[model samples]
Target chain A: MINKTVATLEESVAGIFDGATVMIGGFGTAGQPAELIDALIHQGARDLTIVNNNAGNGDIGLAALLKAGRVRKIICSFPRQSDSHVFDSLYRAGQIELELVPQGNLAVRIQAAGAGLGAIFTPTGFGTLLAEGKETRHIDGKDYVLEYPIKADFALIKAHKGDRWGNLTYRKAARNFGPIMAMAADCTIAQVNQIVSLGELDPESVVTPGIFVQRLVRIQHQPAASAA
Target chain B: MNKWNRDQIAQKVALDIPEGAYVNLGIGLPTRVANFLPPDREIILHSENGILGMGPAPLPADIDPDLINAGKEPVTLQPGGCYFHHGDSFAMMRGGHLDICVLGAFQVSRRGDLANWHTGAPDAIPAVGGAMDLAIGAKKVYVMMDFLTKTGDCKLVDTCEYPLTGIGCVDRLYTDLAIIDIHQGQLLVRELADGLTFDDLQRLTGVTLTYQPAH
Candidate 1:
């Protein structure tokens, strides 16, 4: 039947060991899989290395997980924001580690891992501090720095709809990192608003194919106020 | 001397954008350029978080938490706009698909090297974001910043002291006192603020300036 549906958020996040590299899909709060993150928090995995666009916002979702002392490190582009006080405080106290990569490099490196590429030469951070200690090349009078792929142990993502086969679609800007994170991880767990029949999802419109996604769990759409 | 205010500087930058150009305005002062874009021209705005043809801020009634820009602020989408994933969105920037990108900077060297992302302070939390990609990949990189810091330090200098975003990437610099172009390592003054002369602009800037006004 090729059904990959999981019963509960806890079951979906099961077997996540300590020190696992996890990719949480989101750009700010847009596509963040808050429910799955909450479940992972309750599941009590420690020393996680998270990858996302921002650190956290206003003590919820990723911030809550951080507050629970579950994360050891984070690799992201922009970690500082107005509401990023949780990360800000922890970072100042040196309780957590941070790897600040250029946003384009962060995206393409994850894409490279998913695409099965060894490395890529990008001009983004050439001759800058970020490119220091990295291999650089001059191609056709242009300088480029070598960047490697970033793979993950698991990816937690949010989607608008999913089928039993695990095919998924996302809404608006909420689709930011979900598709790529799914492909870059060994096991991609998705939380979807609705679970539809196999034939209900149009084959052509599937953003994350069933092949990339491993498990799908349906979540009720809670009001925005309760999301935090 | 009467310097150009923030909005006036943005308006000046907006005027230089050609018709039908695809532009990415960095957060902060550069975002104001969107409001002054020529109404007759069809300029496509790109947000790094995966949106193209971006419009202005949405009304409170129409705000959607799912739809936000790179700054985490709610925004609307224009007709013919589309959403994409982060990978494809960054690809658009790094692949040279974008025509212009306006950014804010802390320091810009005479050679057009950009230093905006970090102050190199040991205590500061460094966040690079897409600034480096936009600086190097856009066909034209325009920088909008104050000419001097609050402490009276010049931002346009012979050399940048802070960590660089990109090397030799900036094309034009729009500051409060003058509009300058970086041509083959030379700072060419294109226009000065009202009541400000070339000598006045030179005295304020940290580097040598050449007087080359646009005809």
Candidate 2:
């Protein structure tokens, strides 16, 4: 078993040196760790390889890293190319690299990575770009595509509330990426709006088990910060 | 009933929306389409939150506390509308089951890319919600917004200045001044609001626009 140590969110996350791989919990922006992202931005760390759902809305979450020119490559389900076409321009300019993963396949990959599976077969991308350049296998007279597991050194996520024991609850869209990523990272650093004591949370309300969390930080959103 | 300005835009966008087409109205203004649906036509409304038989937003007094859409907003289910798991709803979206998805836009490019989630503000709540899935998973995407920015700059741009949500996924645009299509990497004017001309739209836009007058 891996040895354990205690650290604050800042200290635990400081393990992420330059060129570290990070798996952030968020689908688009729903489950993104805004406070932690802000912390990373303030640190101005660079050369990150991030795995996420949709290279989430820019300059707000992971996009802040993009804006700060910190991330070097991104492994995600979709690339950001809408309003800010600069992402495409940057990719074309080789400013950063993108590894496109199918949403279903990506979800399964994170699951497999967390489970310590080297790779697995999925039917999600039987005939799309996801099928190209990957191992293929057939079962029951049909084709299946091979997907590799992805785990990161650091996992950044947000929780609606967390206990000192590390159990968590997510509110609404924030629920999407948190559970999946929390289980898949080597170390998870969560920024929660509130922190309660152990056993205070109902069993059913704990979306992510305490086992996955290494450290928790209570970061209150100042009311002015959340105003639309 | 007095219509909210955003609701008026939703109604205008749905006025000629064809019958028998499966449409997914986005949250917020687009959600108002359910209230404006024409009884003479059968336009199936799909809510990402997992209701297929979505009725219009109920009158406040008629609201059922139990009935809600994927957004968790209270809704009135239509007679034929049914509730399902969110997974099933996303299946309908990712499975190419939608005919059209009308979403609000932060910025739309000449090529019809949509960027709606982040406003690029330094400190704000960053939530994509379902915009990414809806933006890319739907069969076709349409954006609804006014022609110019609050400062009066055109939102139709040569390139989106905001962080993008989907690339090459948008097809049509319904603005207060014009109805346009993204064709071959250009915004082609197809129709216009009353008293609006092609030149007027061009003056209000920041991108190079092509005009295709309706016959």
Candidate 3:
């Protein structure tokens, strides 16, 4: 019985101390582990660093976590959007730090962290201001900038289904960063829509294999009273 | 001459796209190009958030909570549409797999330099997501924007003052006033808007231009 199922979101996300580096899986709210995020909020971990694609949207999920002053910094590709007021206010006020990365670079950097690579050379932001302060090298007459891996202490991810052994499958585009983030983190906690018995998940269809996941929690879709 | 409306500009850009091209319609005005794409043409739409073969905006009832473009707007998946991991999608972009990518720009230089994702203003919000990859990776990079800023300053400049998205990456520029091509460091006029002339566009642009009508 290779069951990795935890009793609750809080138990699954336990041992996340302050000043932790956490990777959140999502593009906006799609693949976000809302239950895990809510639990982290209630657990009141502070001074955390978060890595994701975007900053946050509306006042729910990651936005709520940031609004609660839990996050000390964010490393993301796009931190500015119409719906991300919380990040906007905090960033403008110099309360929260931001490390803006290019989208492709962000994805590959996380992938590198998972694959045990120290660094990678990508051509995505070669001549731009984003490439400033980074090492640049020419390979076959084309410029490539060096980007280091982005590993995290814990990864909070969302999935459509997960077996007791932690084999995970995501829904549609919602699978954006979940699989990569799971591999890039030391302990990956997945909040899933359903938890099945071992051998229930089709190994062929498993997007994130049980090897990358450490714990799982069946999500209860109850929205919090408020985070604003 | 009356400036082309946003939809008209999108329609013009849509007309120039060839059949069987794989295109990534960027956020903002470029996203409108999908609505104008001819139904008979089979252009695959790619969104950087891992969606490919995307369709136009879905109706209220047909909106799928899980399916969305990079802009986070709900969209329909075409018959052949599929989604993948973000890493794989970006590999397709940076690996030069896309045929074309249409993006909105703040400024485009005579040498086809792009500067769109940010302004150097102190209070400006910095958001550089996938523009750099698209600019350098796509086979053809097209920019769709107004010829000039609202205050009447030319967006097509001799040199970009803002941060560069990619070095000499733009192939064609589709603006309300004209459609121009950047060839060998020259801005070649392909088509002028109705009631606009070569001299008038040259004056408004404040840059050197040569007229070579599209055949």
Fnat: each model in turn: 0.91, 0.00, 0.79
Please write out the lDDT profile of model 1 over residues A1-228, one tens digit for every residue.
788999899999999999999999988888899899999999999999999988988888898999999999999999998989999999999999999999999999999999999999998998888888999999999998999999999999999999988899998999999999999999999999899998798888889998999999998765373233
What CAPRI grade goes to candidate 2? incorrect
DockQ of candidate 1 against the true complex: 0.77
Tell me the tens digit of each residue's lDDT in model 2 across B112-176: 77777768775432445456667766888888887777898788887788877676778988777
lDDT of 2: 0.70
Candidate 1: fraction of native contacts reproduced:
0.91
The residue-by-residue lDDT of candidate 1 on B1-215, one tens digit each, is: 89899999999999999998999999889999998999999999999999999999988888888888878789999999999999899889989999999999999999999999999999989999999999988999999999999999999988899999999999999999999999997889999999999998888876899999997
Name the best candidate (by DockQ).
1
What is the alpha-carbon lDDT of model 1 when measured against the actual structure? 0.92
Q: Per-residue CA lDDT of candidate 2, range A1-228, in tens?
A: 322223444654666779888888754454567768877877767899988766645446567677778889888765653433445556667788778665556666787787789998765545333456888898886566788888888889877788877788866444655766777888888878778766788997687888998778877553232221
Name the top lDDT candidate. Answer: 1
- Comparing chain B with the reference, what is the TM-score for each candidate? 0.98, 0.90, 0.97
Q: What is the lDDT of residue B16 in candidate 3?
A: 84
lDDT at residue B205 of model 1 (Cα atoms): 72
Give the root-mean-square deviation of each candidate in angstroms.
1.2, 10.2, 1.9
**Per-residue lDDT of candidate 3, residues A22-91 (tens digit):** 9999898878777789899999899999999999889888999999999999999999988899999999
Tell me the deviation in Å of residue B173 in model 2: 21
Ranking by TM-score: 1, 3, 2
Rank candidates by DockQ, best first: 1, 3, 2
